[model samples]
Target: MSFGAHRPMSVLTWLATPVLFTASVLGLIGLGGMLLDADWRVALSSALFGPAAAVTVLLAGFVEWRTVRCRWCLGLGYPAVVFVAGLLLGDVTLSSPVALALGIPALTVLGVLMRRERNRVIPIA
Candidate 1:
């Protein structure tokens, strides 16, 4: 969508993206960690409110608007990349691959919603 076609997003909507994204990632990690008998709390909490999460959301938003030019990257692509990166970094395992698999589609849908709403210009009454 073009800038001219874009409407300003509410603060709640803006914040909700990261909040929901972070929550999904953490929930998956927690669930997987439990299944794997790993330390899910530390893994979940640390990543949830941590700087990394914030940075990730901001970076994804910027990248979506600038470079990627698509919400799929932020929603799906980012998680996929994160998943692969985690695997390469030994952060993900067969038992606990939540961020990559589950997070991708969830975030992708969210990104689509965010994109659609952001691009719509409501007629002034």
Candidate 2:
């Protein structure tokens, strides 16, 4: 059942992280320039590349999520937070307070559920 030492995922999975990281750097740079109000090109590049950067970050998060062990917490936490943030991005004024209010209670409940689910036994009837 062992493929190799220190290589849990496939070769492509290993390659994907760095490739996405390198490709996303240009987009991130564009975003920084846009933030500074540098010029039209900066704005254009940021508009064009921002989604790529966001997607790359999400992909990286997903890859990391799969590596940890948990009934659900390890994999779901990052994406769940990201989803909530995205959901609230349109109303930035209220996003922080809302995220905190919603996130804390939801995560607390999730932790309790995870603990409860961890040791469930199914009868082999």
**Would you give me the overall lDDT of model 1?**
0.52
Candidate 1 residues 1-125, lDDT tens each? 55564354543454455546654565566566666877433243333445434545554443324334455545455545444443354443333455445555666767786778767677886
RMSD of 2: 14.0
> Per-prediction RMSD in angstroms?
10.5, 14.0
Q: Provide the TM-score for each candidate, comma-separated.
A: 0.37, 0.28
Off by over 4 Å in 2: 1-95
Local error of candidate 2 at 75, Å? 16
- Candidate with maximal TM-score: 1
Q: Which residue pairs clash within candidate 2?
A: none
lDDT of 1 at 107: 68
At residue 125, candidate 1 shows an lDDT of: 69
